[model samples]
Target: MTKSQPYTQADLAKLGNVLIYLVDRLGPISKTKALKLIYLVQEVSVKTYGLPFFNMPFLVWRLGPVAEDVFVDLSAEEPVLLANYIQRQEEDCKTFIHASQPFSDDEFSDNEMEILALVAKTYGSLSAERLVEVIHRPHSLWYQTARENGVLDYLEQGRMTTTNFEIDFGRLLDDMPERKRMYTGQLDYLEQSRALKV
Candidate 1:
């Protein structure tokens, strides 16, 4: 897909709802943390269910994997789509996003809601710094794409492609332990690449 392809209004609304759910469940989290949580939800959903979570492209942004249209909606000023659900606050030079209102689950499917809940349970308590470290692994899709082509589609390249996107856990049952460690930031990037022989 091209860089200019926009996420549908439904996708944007669902993302806002995801943000609201995360904040409500995990307490206030930084914008960076919220973005990473969303990315992880998409990543795991793709691998586990072989379905596109947002049906939108994400780029290897400097901060990590970022969905362009979602980024815009989240970054927009007051009166934006998320303004009604979330509020941004600055504390000690860091920006945090908190839920401004309760969010309903009407936008997501049962499986989609399950994925969001699983991700929140897994990574919601981690500090943003730890999340950043985990997501920026040199072996991650974002890092590999950014290394090949500079961040943000510098050469008009399409969305970042990941071999792990459709990985079959059943096929790798023997290696699941290692893979789990890698995803959880237990393995260093070099070690992960070496293990995978990438």
Candidate 2:
């Protein structure tokens, strides 16, 4: 989609639940780590299921893939969307996120829940800086998008800038030819269906 899109109330609730789930499983986490974990969950879900866990658009930021709205909400002094589900606390000069409410799986499918657990188990223990390094690896979607958008060059030149490049989720299928074919076919069907709706 575009670099940003408005999330419906249902969408915000689902995102909030997911965040609470992560916080409950991983213990209190940094905003950076929580954001990266969300990205990882999306990445794994796309690669394995041929769809994203959430409809949220990820931007190729300097650290990694970031959902701008979630980032802003988490950083806000009073979070509007996730205020009921998560709370931010400052300790040792760093902000940590905690679950303010019990997580509900109502918004997730069985497969989605599995993927969430898998991502938490796989990357939960890593520090935010470590997660950043992981996402920066060659061939990672964030790395590829950032490189294409000149964010990498900007960093190499030691220039300070705010770059928000949309990460192309379709590229996740590049290495899987069969999956790519299937994914494209589904996309074609979707386009046709939308056209019919018009």
Candidate 3:
């Protein structure tokens, strides 16, 4: 609504909790790995400590290649921040976004918003194994969550399920002049027209 109020601290906590919930829901995460992760996060942030916006992209941006160095305790060969790094650019609250680009103030579509909400809910909570469970089919048949081959079922569903939200979920796309229609609309201000302007 208003840029004056940033996301509340409580919102962050809820988001974090939701992430944890999603992970657990998708889990059979071993207690050992979970505990190890908790401890490792606590430990590793030590050197990279006190950085205000502790997003992975920011760390990687500032540290460059050094950030590629692993967090040995976690057993990760490459240390990585575990979220979909979205940016908020104030002089103080600078963060990251998709494709390493600055996010603008444009409104998101309902489905896109839902996708974000799901992600915020699912973020830090889900382990790699759990996330792979929800997002991708497990490589082994034993791991299938669906009664049938869930991955194959999902692939067939995806074929026609409007996978690209930018176009699919966007109301503006619906507002666009339909194909094979007459040129009743102007293209001057459309994003695709920008390059053509020159």
Best by TM-score: 2
- Local distance difference test, each candidate: 0.65, 0.80, 0.27
lDDT of 2 by residue, 96-156 (tens): 8998889988889999999989988999999999998898898788778778876787754
Candidate 3 to truth, TM: 0.21
Alpha-carbon RMSD to native, per candidate? 11.3, 3.4, 17.7
Model 3 over residues 1-198: C-alpha lDDT tens digits? 111223333333333332243334333233222332332232222212211111111011111111121122112322133232211122333221112223321333344334434443534465544533432334222122221423344433443221111101111133444521211132222323433432
| True lDDT of residue 71, candidate 3 | 23
Q: On residues 67-118, what C-alpha lDDT tens digit does candidate 1 reach at each position?
A: 6555665565552756667888877877788887788798899998999999
Q: Which sections of candidate 1 miss by over 4 Å?
A: 1-7, 150-198
Please give the RMSD of candidate 2 to the true structure: 3.4
lDDT of 1 at 168: 23
Q: Which regions of candidate 2 are displaced past 4 Å? A: 1-4, 156-158, 181-198
Give the CA lDDT, 0 to 100, for residue 61 in model 3: 12
